[model samples]
Target: MTEPIRISRTGSVETWTINRPESGNAITGKDVIAAFEAAAEGANADIAVRAVILTGEGKIFSAGGNVKEMADRQGMFGLDPIEQRWAYVDGIQRIPRALGRLEVPIIAAVNGAAVGAGCDLAMMCDIRIASERASFAESFVALGLIPGDGGSWFLQRAIGYERAAEMTFTGDRIDAPTALAWGLVSRVVPHDELVSTATELAERIAQNPSHSLRMAKRLLLESRTGTLESTLAMAAAMQPLAHADAEHQQRIARWRSS
Candidate 1:
């Protein structure tokens, strides 16, 4: 079988593409966990890899979970409810864990529809850039399911509680422009330019010193749950190390000279 996620390097940037377009890139069976693990491994293995761009092949970014599996009571939904609950704990739940552990910044290039868990996956990233054709929905309710993969948490952070509640309750689709207006995505580009636009953004970020980039990302993640005072203290602790790094001194000199 082919890899569900494919990782490639261009300079300091790593691109991870979801390759299961045939099934609309659905997170079915083990693919969701497998793909996320690959991302974590790829990012960790290469010290030179500075940034990551995640996009899906073909039209849809992802349709979320496998509808067929859900309906047929196969795959992750197999056996009894108790078993399925454990399946979730051991299966798709790993995606968020793997992704959350990645120190480097991640960019999600949503090329098309990202519904249900798919939208949550994009939200897991540090930044999101969507194609004009892209749409998003917290669509678990539509299928009589809740976002068991941290969508509730991610959605509220991305678009706020009011809008996230609206999307979650209604499971309505938000087009790219609306998504941008809601601050769900940083920008929306033409459909054909999605990958290129994301790549350009990743390359720009990759140009930064790798250690600093990772530290900055960690600081942002810490800010999500930390108090202002706590965040400030953490930053104070980290700042000295950043200042002491040779790369920091070199960049400072370059900046002053230029």
Candidate 2:
């Protein structure tokens, strides 16, 4: 079988493309899920890999799950409900867990329709840039399912509770402009420019000191669930470490000489 994911490097930035356009980049299968988990781990272990861009092949960023398999009670939705629950715990949920632990920043370049779990995947990234052709939906309800992959948590955080609820309840897709207005994506570009735009953004981020970037990302994650006092305390702890990093020390030395 062909590789489900394609990871390529351009300077300090890596672009991770979902290569299974034939399946609409259905990602709930074991192979795709493991591919994602492995990609996250590889990036986490490599400090030289400064940034990442996530996108998909063909017209859809991803369709989220294998609908045929879901209907057939195969793959991700296989066996009994009890077994399927474990399947979810040991399968698709790993994507978020791995992504949450990623030290470097991630950007999603949404080239087209991002529906169901697909939209949630984009939300997993630290930043999102959508193509003018791009769209998003929390469309589990339309399929008679809920976002079995933690879309509930990520969606609300991206666009707030009310809007997230509206999308979730309606399972309606919002186009790129509306997504931007609602703050789902940072910006929208023409279809042909999505990759270049995302790469430029990733490259800009990669130019920063890697350790500082990781620390800043960590603090942002902490802020989501932490109280202001707790967030401040964490930042205080990380600030010293950032200041003492060799990269920072080198910059200070160079500044002194100049």
Candidate 3:
């Protein structure tokens, strides 16, 4: 049986690929939870892995959910339609929360179409790099649903409230160039070079001090929801530990010698 997700590593960069290409790489609710769990565990346990790259196996990154599975589940349970849909929402919404808590940086290599929850997944990552052929859409509204997978949070933070509202309301698809212009992705590259460019960026990040990188990620996450005064206090508490690290000392000594 084929795995829903595939993991590989290149040096300190771990790559997780969504393997269901026949479905436009769509992820089921179960798949989203499982993928996030596996990726988070792998990144946390391996000291050698300083960064992670998320992508999809074939032509598309992800089309979002497995609609056929949804249909089958509804048929099997014969449950109230609203209740069944809520179950689906609960399962898939955990993915972004898991990604957000990861200690290391994540780079989404958007190879093709990323719609609905798929677009949320990409936006949750620390950085996104897209291929020329990549497209994105906040497609939930068109289906009479809302962004359930933390899309509202990440999208609003990424491109601001107006743009997020526009995309979510219209469910309009945006190409890579427009995505970049709208600050959805960090950069766009040719289709053939997407993986290479993303990998290169990951490698560059991995070369930095891993502990410091993790701490910086924590600080950045904290700053998002923390009040200015609280953030300042947190930073003050963290500063001494950062300065006391052996890596920090070594850099200081080197600077003094120069």
Candidate 4:
């Protein structure tokens, strides 16, 4: 069997594809978790990797959790509820944890249906670009399941509490335009142009000095829950290090000459 997650590099951008197209990229087992962890590790270790684009292969982005696994109580979702809880903490939960620590920027290229866990995965990324064919749902509620992969934490933050509440309660699929209207996605493009557009955006971001890029991402992530005073303090602390870098000096010189 081929690897469920495929990594490809182009310049400073790393692209991760959820490769189980036949099954609609249904997330399961250690493959997805290991993939996420590896992404974090590789990006952190390599200064050249400045951005990441995540999407699924073929048509469907992801069908969220494996329904067959859930039905049969196989893999992570065993017969016991406690076993399920442990599975979440040690398994799927690792995706969010690893992603949260990743300092490089990530753009979710939502090419098709991003249901349940898939939707949450997109929310974890710093930016999202959706194809016209893309759709989304907080769909676990329909199956009597909850967002076992930090959906509750990421949803309200991305689209506000009220919009998040509606999606979670109803479990209704929302099209790409609806996602754009709700601020869930930054752009909706023609299906064929999705990857190219996302790649262009990633390349633009990657052109910046890697150290400053990482620091800027770190500062923004900190600001999510930080007060104005605390945020300012963080900026003050970061400024000295940024100013000391040769890359910042060169950029400053170029700005002066222009």
Q: What is the Cα-based TM-score of model 2?
A: 0.97
The residue-level lDDT of candidate 1 at 58 comes to: 89
Candidate 3, position 54, lDDT: 94
Candidate 3 C-alpha error for residue 139, in Å: 0.6
Residue 257 CA error for candidate 4 (Å)? 3.2
Q: Which regions of candidate 4 deviate over 4 angstroms?
A: none
lDDT of each: 0.90, 0.92, 0.85, 0.92
Residues 132-200, candidate 3: write the lDDT tens digits: 999999999887878877789989899989999999999999999999999999899999999999999
Residue-by-residue lDDT tens digits, candidate 2, 52-142: 9999999999999888888887765667889888988998899999899899999999999998999999999999999999999999999
Angstrom error at residue 72, model 2: 2.1
For residues 98-172, could you state the per-residue lDDT of candidate 4 as single tens digits? 999898999999999999998999999999999999999999889998888999999999999999999999999
Worst 10 residues of 1 by lDDT: 27-36
Q: Candidate 4 clash total?
A: 0
Instruction: Give the lDDT of residue 61 in candidate 1.
Output: 93
| Whole-model lDDT, model 3 | 0.85
Which parts of model 1 have CA positions greater than 4 angstroms off?
none
The residue ranges of model 3 lying beyond 4 angstroms of the native Cα positions read 71-90, 254-258
Q: Estimate the TM-score of every prediction.
A: 0.96, 0.97, 0.91, 0.97
Candidate 3 structure, TM-score to reference = 0.91
Highest-scoring model, lDDT:
2
lDDT (tens digit, per residue) of candidate 1 on 1-258:
888988888998988888888888887558657878877977977779999999888899988898887888777676788988888888888888899889888999999999888899999999999999999999999988899998998999999999999999999999999999999999999998988999999999999988888889999999999999999999999999999988999999999999
